[model samples]
Target: MVMENEEVSFADTVFGFWEDSQVHSVNSSNSSNDEEENYDDEEETFCTKEKNKAFWEEQGQLLQATLCRTSSIETKVRHATKEALGELNASERRCICGQLEVAKAKSCCRNCLDRDIRDRLLSLGFNCYISKSKWNNSPGTPSGEHTYLEVIDTSNSKRGEVKVVIELSFRAEFEMARANEEYNQLIMKLPEVFVGKGERLRVLVKILCSAAKKCMKEKNIHLAPWRKQKYMLAKWLGTYDRSTMETLPRAYTNRPQKPKTSMLTYDLLEKIPGLHCTTAVEVV
Candidate 1:
């Protein structure tokens, strides 16, 4: 009887110890799991904080850059505006095109509107390269002979500068149609040329008309025509759809759809704290 009791007690004690050990093991496992979860949460928080810090820093840099750019643009505009006003005040005689002819002439023709426009651009710190044969090498030359102007930055050297190909029309209707044709041809050819040369091409059309009743007829008739032309150009050149279009079409296409990514990118860029658009053209 004593031996049986001792055996029973030993079995009960062993079973209780085993149960206690299992409970302790479970508690230990739970505590370890909690610590791991806490560590993961801390790690995620650290990563998020670092990302936020980097994003703000990048935004600050972009803001500074944007402000500097705006200041420079404003200065240029002031200078250009002063020069244009001075030219207008100095010129009294009207050319054949009914536009004022400035005094300085590169050639003998005083009645030439193109020359007057060229001179005006020159006064605005652009180098008129229209007369040069070398600069006249445009892909769409024979059918569309456009004037090319180099925007000279006096602050920087002449090695790298903004190159502009311009088509000036004294008449709005004729010019708009012609500009569209010319833009289409150039857009088709420029990509290949850009890829080969690793340079970007910028083209502009300047329409010059008198403020007289016969030419303008209304307060802002020119705005609609100009806006349409620019919109068509943007569409044809693939600038409007490049970022958001799903199916990859040709670079220069008549069909343009708003890109999904482009609006987001534009919004992000606009929200860069101090960024502002200061150029005559929004894209530029």
Candidate 2:
């Protein structure tokens, strides 16, 4: 009987020990999980910072390299484009077609501004054209169309024709609403107006698209279809229809009107019979 009682007590003791160990184990596990979570958050923050820094540095290098490789024709076109913008800024003219402000490039009347710039470029002896690119809705990107200016240079007999793309709102186009500081700073480096060769423009597009993708990834947001690299490249590099916009009339000017006599009294006297009786006073 004593042996059986001892065995029972031993079994009970073992059970009690297991229950106590289980309680302590749960508490330790909870503590460990919290520490792990904190460590993960810290690591993520560190990685994000490093990534942003690296991205900005690499982008700067790429932009510098791309800008340095410019041709004589590109430089000439760029200067001409800037000169055209300065003239528009100083002029007090409105586009005849849109009847909108063209004094500033960022005017609400974007169409008018574009048309005016194209006209000015043509007048400056550059073979400029408006390129309209259209794409249908695909699996990834939606249907869209884009219009921008291009200056074609066929001056060199050996090099053939060179195409220079001009974008007035180049910097504003790449700006993001939910961008980090690094991304914003990188965008600031871009010119308000971009005038470069097709190859340079292509490189810039790739750089900006990658930056946009990184930004959205860090922010945990889905990038818009239009912001994708492929979509952006399709805008300029894709098949496009070109037009010189020669059909549009030139901007009308406000010329001085000739002084005329007041015919209001004569018209009223002739048209209105006895209903309107006017007393005419002669000035001596």
Candidate 3:
């Protein structure tokens, strides 16, 4: 009996020892899993920080490039404007140079300007004059308006006999109308001279102004400095206040005719018999 009791006690001790060993093994495995999870979390956090840094760097570079481009363009425009002023003629018959603050920048690009100008002129019942020079692309700043020179035919009388050199500083509505009338009158008189009778007739058209605009998908770049100046002049005249605006006494010349040419002024309009320089605005 005692032997059997000893055998039973030994079996109980072996079972208890086996159960304790299994519990210790399970705890060690749990600790190892917790350490691996912490390592993975640290790695993910480091990667997120690096990604944020890269994104900010790219954005900064783009902003800097844009600012540089804007500064460069402004500088060029000012230079171009100053250059235009020096090109005008003193007699006002050979060259036209002037400046004005435009209402807004042009909406069209360089490629579309010729079409726009042609369309605008045609709508006004005048032919579009293609400029003699190509687009000016030199990098220069413009401080003021545009300049132009045109040799126009006013009469058909002698088929190239009577040509007027007209120089205009601005493109105000009144100014454009006046110029167009003068040019049209010259053209009308051309047929009276009997074309093909003798001399060769050639009309010269030139654009002598430059304005700079940025090239972009949404905005077009074909800008005429002459047009801008004209626009500015028109706006200025409309808003002119005698209290603040200065005026110069201008000596006006009579519309030149072959037999009779006279120097007249606005003050002398009432005293002069056929020399009144007043005419109604007529659209041709």
Question: Backbone clashes per model, in order?
Answer: 2, 0, 31
How much is 274 displaced in model 1, in angstroms? 73
Name the lDDT of candidate 2. Answer: 0.82
Q: Candidate 2's residue-wise lDDT over 1-284, tens digit each?
A: 45644555777889899999999999999999999999999999999789778877999889778867888888988898888778777655655665563434445266667777788888889998888889888999888888888988998889798889998888988898889877788788898988998889999999999888988887889999889988998888787998884566544344444667577546765676756776998999
RMSD, every candidate, angstroms: 28.1, 9.7, 23.1
**TM-score list, all predictions:** 0.30, 0.73, 0.25
Which pairs clash in the backbone of model 1?
244-259, 244-260
Q: Which candidate's TM-score is highest?
A: 2
Q: Which regions in candidate 3 have their CA more than 4 angstroms from the true location?
A: 1-11, 70-74, 77-284
Candidate 3, position 22, lDDT: 85
- Please tell me which predicted candidate would have the highest lDDT against the true structure: 2
What candidate 1 gets wrong by more than 4 Å, as runs, is 1-7, 62-284
Local distance difference test values of all predictions, in order: 0.37, 0.82, 0.32
lDDT of 1 by residue, 1-284 (tens): 45644555777889999999999999999999999999999999999768745644544444334323323533553355345435544554333333433233222232253344455656556554333212122232221112222233444565465333232221222233323332233223211101000022112211111112112332333433323333323322221111111221211122344766766356754568777766686664
lDDT of 3 by residue, 67-162 (tens): 233223223322333233222211121100112111111322222332333333334443223223223222332233232221223335555433
Candidate 3's TM-score: 0.25
| Of candidates 3 and 2, the better by lDDT | 2
